[model samples]
Target: MSSVRIILNFLSGFGVLANIFLLVFYTFIILCHRPKPTDMISCQLTFIHIVLLITGPDIWLWDIFESLNIDNDFKCKTTFYINRMMRSLSICITCLLGVFQAVTISPSSSLLNKFKYKLKKYMISAFLFIWSFNLPFTCHRIIYSGAFTNVSETKQMKATKFCSLFSMNHIIRALILTVATSRDVFLVGLMLATSAYMVIILFRHKRQHKHLHSLSHLKASPEKRATQTILLLVVFFVVMYWVDFIISFTAILLRMYDPVILSIQKFVMNVYPTITPLIQISSDNRIINMLKHMQSLCHHIFKWR
Candidate 1:
């Protein structure tokens, strides 16, 4: 096997392991007890993460097979289409998670609250819309041609899969790039603005005091912890996603098409989903307390009965 093959295999294996760990952690949270709406959204994000992880390995595996001169056109096109679609869906769902959390934290008197009920009602519809909008891009995958094989190099030549644009003309490429970049920027901006609002609300809440007893309880409350967790999550997402955006933009401008850059992009994208479950678990004290209380009650009931 060539060096490229080895690297691809390594990344594929690592992604698989990371996704498995995330799945197990999410399962533990679910088995412990039912989760709140926010945690449920986080759990859904984890499921998307698992799907990405499972599909991620195939990209690398395809690269390995190509390097080793193994041709499989059917596998190439299928993997390419599935991977691209699922990855796009993952990105969309992640953005949705951020938006949902932000809305959930919005103050009751804020204008955003006026449409809060509509937001909840259209959550699934919005998700469906995202998927539908992205489906067209992936539909061209069916007509994608596998890479040409080099018969001189090896007796058993392998066909590689490359992203085939239905229209590779300058106009199409420019339009697609514009749309993708704009979408990403809009989502990132919204996320940052909402997070900033949340931080301001938290600071104001902290500065004000109710009664003495209420103040003491609030000081040691789960709400404070949840706020801290959300802040941390927002920070984590901002930093990671910014790094990815910078790298991606640089690559696009420089016209540098390297596998390493692609690999890093994939890694960063996958990390958010995997780590989301942990954030949800740590942030929600109610879930933890409920789990413990249920266990205790079960033990006592079993002993008495």
Candidate 2:
């Protein structure tokens, strides 16, 4: 129960609350307006985020649980299970969105134009695949996932390491790292490639048409803006992810305190999920307008009642 653990838990708890508040607002607007395809992607991402907010990383009711100073084996397994599932799914969905946006914005003559047509046609299948494909990998968490008798006063859940005592843990850790790093590297590369191509497309469009008032320019603006947002997201992901990876590897090498490593990773991972809705709000005028209308509707409804 170090001060660092307490502070990290408190911040995670706050982040969970913030995510919930913003999600409610975003959900209200989306439901009222009827979500478009891209909005549905946002909705899917947000849905995975509910698990993120309420489970893992000592975020779910952290203050309440920490004060009681108790954690169970069942709770640890369940939390980490959902954490593994949702983390995998979120990254998959994010990569999909990046690819979708890239293809959707590509010009008719571009090679990626084929993907624009196929993406919508295949999006449902893609989603289904994401769930089914990750199940096996996520289930692998069962090997070392469990609870501890020694729950610290500063923390409710002792960070469980089922493999820490085993000589075989190294082999298992290597396998886990291999699977995880391979997947991450592939997705990250896809995002970077798509982002770079999309940027090139945008610049080409601008160069071809210097006139901002042209019909093509107006049509291109929203696409470019959304793609740019995705690129920003990709940038953020790449930077934070590498930082976390390095820290995590170093922590393992040096045998750093579990709480310190947990605290660092928790803060690092939560950054994107916490702020994603705000990113959508800033980039999407449609959502903003819908929110405005929803606010007025609610105001009227309350007055009528």
By lDDT, who's the top model here?
2
lDDT per model, in order? Answer: 0.62, 0.70
Give per-residue CA lDDT, model 1, range 1-305, as digits (tens).
65654665555556556556555655666678664445545555556656555555345546566687765665566666676676666656666666666666678888777766777788768867987887886665556434435434432222232432232557866776788778767876776776787788777776675435554655546655765676677667778878877877766564443567766676676666556556665556655676689899999999999
Clashes of each: 0, 0
RMSD after Cα superposition, model 2:
4.9
Model 1, residue pairs in steric clash:
none
lDDT of 1 at 200: 84
Candidate 1 ranges with C-alpha deviation above 4 Å:
1-35, 57-71, 140-145, 148-167, 210-224, 250-256, 259-263, 286-305
Q: Worst lDDT window (10 residues) for model 1?
A: 156-165
In candidate 2, what are the lDDT values of residues 138-248, reduced to their tens digit?
775555656544333323223433212112356877898898889999998997888888789778877877866767556646667787887787677677778877877
Q: Deviation in angstroms for 172 in model 1?
A: 1.3
By TM-score, who's the top model here?
2
Residue 157 of model 1 has an lDDT of: 21
lDDT, candidate 2, at 281: 66
